[model samples]
Target: MTVPGSAPTPPDPFAPARLGPLTLRNRVIKSATFEGVTPEGLVTDELIAYHRRPAAGGVGMTTVAYCAVSPEGRTERHQIWMRPEAVPGLRRLTDAVHREGAAVSAQIGHAGPVADARSNRLPALAPGRFLSPLGMRMTRAATAEDIARVIRAHAAAARIAVESGFDAVEMHFGHNYLASSFLSRRLNHRDDAYGGSLANRAEVALGIARAVRDEVGDTIAVTAKLNMDDGVPGGFWLDESLQVARRLQEEGTVDALELTAGSSLLNPMYLFRGEAPLSEFAAVFPRPMRLGIRLAGRRFLHAYPYEEAFLLPSARQFRAALSLPLILLGGITRRATVERAMAEGFEYVAMARALLREPDLVNRMAEDRDVRSLCIHCNKCMPTIYTGTHCPLVGPLAGPPAPPLTGDGGRPRPHAS
Candidate 1:
């Protein structure tokens, strides 16, 4: 049943709720963000620690970010790949999270044309050929055979996700990745069966959903992170996304929809607003890209003002349109915004930067009932993914903190509130 639009008694964000086949302790989910801990696509102690800390801190579910279905599908070589050998390490990670009282999920996806050839050392694939800004090379338009293989690869990865003891799996259908690239009319220029009209572009997404559902069945819940708007003028917008959402709902493949916006390829700042750390971002790249950033840094690291519940305005349109539960992502910091999200009919709130800033922010809120996040939304944490994902003001990943945090192995600050 859908949560009513009319405020149905503001819910305690801490209360447990049902999400598909699983029941979460709360409506809070850790939105997937790249963890630069793994090397060679294998889970390391640091990788497990990264997720395990949040799980222990308190989240309904913690999603391991941007796991590739195949090796070449990865954005970087260190990103986890779904395979038999990967299962054991993943199992260990999931077991750790589960022990922390939070269910774990895997964000499975293909970087496609977003794959960095310079970093991952692999040619990028997309719905149509184009020059890649990151890869610095011409991308290969996926052949029909390649498309079929990628679809199957996602299904095969779902099976591994289940084997690895994940409570749920989220297909990454946003951020101009493989499936999202197809949705963007600006990106997908092919006239084949998989391109041109909106329906054709949507086929690959639906196919992936059905294929993954078939593999996982009722054993684990299936979720999708879909774009509400690509945030680029010519990209996939809300009107088209609503149709895709309705289709996914009708197809019975996805149990919940996590709505996000912006294209990592086009308008990245659309996804994470606030101060755009241009020089910090430029530092991560090689000399060639660094030189390019020095010339066009402002355009590349576009700035958007930060606001709590930043996605609520756009996501509410979806809440009125679809009955399937919606998970709102973006700028979810303080308890007020979370309550606001629930009051507005959003079933769950997914947080990224807030959680990164305070891994135990949920627990801190639970204790104080009024604790607020300290994330300034400088967006410097974004470039940290190239080396390590951490907040500049918090944690061991970014150096000494002004005042240490309480959870995720940081020194306790009982007076944090």
Candidate 2:
């Protein structure tokens, strides 16, 4: 009898590990699930509390999600964009997480076609013109000048992250964002140097990674969340993605690669395999958009069955193809899975929904080797991104919406901010 992909006694998942220049307490990282608490494109006390809970709960590192590289790169107006004005608040957030004894990383990227043009009041750029259902408009095809600007923006974002005291910066190259858009043959129809061939298409992602590394120079560990597959027919699939991963490994700019899947543009649910919360998602948008979602949500949010370590099979390909450190994401729910990832040679394991369901789960897992996560994979938390991201099955955020607190010594103030 043979244990599949078995190796020598696996390193303890709870042991300290080095990621580039920083030493993390353990091998587990809290994957970035866009915290919707930053309503003014700046940090809020709510945002700090959101990250603090997981750090205190015992993640080796807690990632602050979707810090856009520029104003126009944001998915919507409320998302945080890296800027000098944003640093002080980010500094406070980093400090809070540091007090919990966990390193913090900022996940930065340009949303591109994923950007909501109506809410951002700015044109969203894509590799080629495409109809954006979320913004109800056609995305503008990115120009050469626009590409240069976005590349510079990534470097600037990394500098800001360093100044704000982030221990790591995970460049977002997944989920059909700006760089990921260029990688897709189905989306990038341009005849320019930045399109057609895989190498040309990869120029954007490679350039951004090099620029970011040049700007920060190991001051903070640089990692990238890269798509292993886009999950759309004729999109960026494994064959091309393996080559892209090889190039990233060759460049040696990123310290580690966190492998992910799904297209935020065409197939958002592929990344998080489980029940698609269609009704909950529809409830968050305006009536017109809600109607659209009700009509078409199933097509976009196609459900995939839940399983333990869902991405491990694909991640194993990367592990086999490249020597760069790999973070296995998707369906990481229990201590056994983390151990499984380690046994298979993955450097770290990242979790989002599980930590959201029970913030103290890592600590609990440390105490009990057989511990399992409480997340039911219902994904009701998916729709909460528009309001405040929380698992509806647990804690204060659960149940019916509470009435807003009154101002003026508990008397209802007619015009409260």
Candidate 3:
């Protein structure tokens, strides 16, 4: 039988694995990929259907991408928010994915200074005033009061996620977001107890994790998407990340840690990799082609030219330090890579781009031993999502597009006209 991607499907990749207290049917996990299907930060039918495909595809677990804990600190206004009003739709999403027999995780976070002020119309807050690599000047530094508010926001979001029927919540502690900003000396230039020293720099993350753990208790699994390195000169490097990871484990605030790298703001190309067709705003501040080419030269620079199980080595380093379950992400598109990751000490292997190319890939890989995933790692899907474009690679098999939102008076209405 031919698989969806037309590559030889490998033998059953669905061997059981464990994440926290939950026992998964297989080692495969559909990593978080932002689809922009949710409307006004609320779960919609399109979002449910988008996730259901992967659940039915036989992955052990699938993580919903980038739910904002604070509306003012969000990347997109249409991104899901874990508020009381959003709980019902989120409950429906959980129920639908559960029926397909796959566990689900919701990734919760705040964008901090990375949030687009013009788009969201909200003031951005960061650890300290600094220039964004994107060229936007940071407006303000987060105060003690602001820190308290954001910490509570995370806890509140975690509570809502658990109450809404999510089986797990993954904290976004990477990619130069709030937690990562505080952890990196390059970004956090404060003299307070929350910065200056390594221990101080990690205080915010530790506080947020503790609050989430306290609010959710032992009911829902809590994992963190952590950056192994920020991939910039004088950025958050492996040594500091290891220290922070050890501290988090000691505090008993996290169940699993997924190692990732690169700062989305400082190194967008590195984070997503490849040419992202310029959107209106992205074009407003374009980097010179020569600078882009220079950044792309480093082997670890961009996300393109994917290699299987790319993050395993860093994960292995972390494994030697902590006994917590480790999740290895990046470029895992085949069964052999998955097996190799597990053998190298990764408790779980997460695939984002690969699964986007073929949502039914896990099932096909499970059914035959010759199937290879079809993802070209072109990174086209990354930018297309901002424009509300569905994954062209999988959209045919997935379904029709939902109504497009109109450009009506700053309100999100279906694109009509």
Q: Where does model 1 exceed 4 Å of error?
A: 1-7, 286-291, 397-417
List the candidate 3 regions with Cα displacement exceeding 4 Å.
1-13, 131-137, 273-305, 394-417
The numbered model that scores best in TM-score is 2
Give the alpha-carbon lDDT of every model.
0.83, 0.86, 0.74
Whichever of 1 and 2 has more lDDT, that candidate is 2
Quote each prediction's TM-score: 0.92, 0.93, 0.86
Tens digits of per-residue lDDT, candidate 2, 1-417, equal 448795567778998999999999999999988776776778988889889989999999999987999988988777789999999999999999999999999999999888877777788899988897656668999999999999999999999999999999999999888999999998998899999999999999999999999999979999999999998998999989999999988989999999999988888888888998889877755566588778987987899999888888888988998999999999999898898899889999999989888999999999998899989999888766655677988853332232222221111100000
lDDT of 3 at 257: 88
Q: Best by lDDT, which number?
A: 2
Which scores higher on lDDT, 1 or 3?
1
Candidate 1: residue 18 lDDT (0-100)? 90
Write the residue-wise lDDT of candidate 1 on 24-131 in tens digits. 999999989887766557887778888987888899899998689998788756678899999889999999999999999999988887776555667788988889
Clashes of 1: 0
- lDDT, candidate 1, at 235: 92
Candidate 1 positional error at 39, Å: 1.4
What's the lDDT of the predicted structure labeled candidate 3? 0.74
Q: Of 1 and 3, which scores higher on TM-score?
A: 1
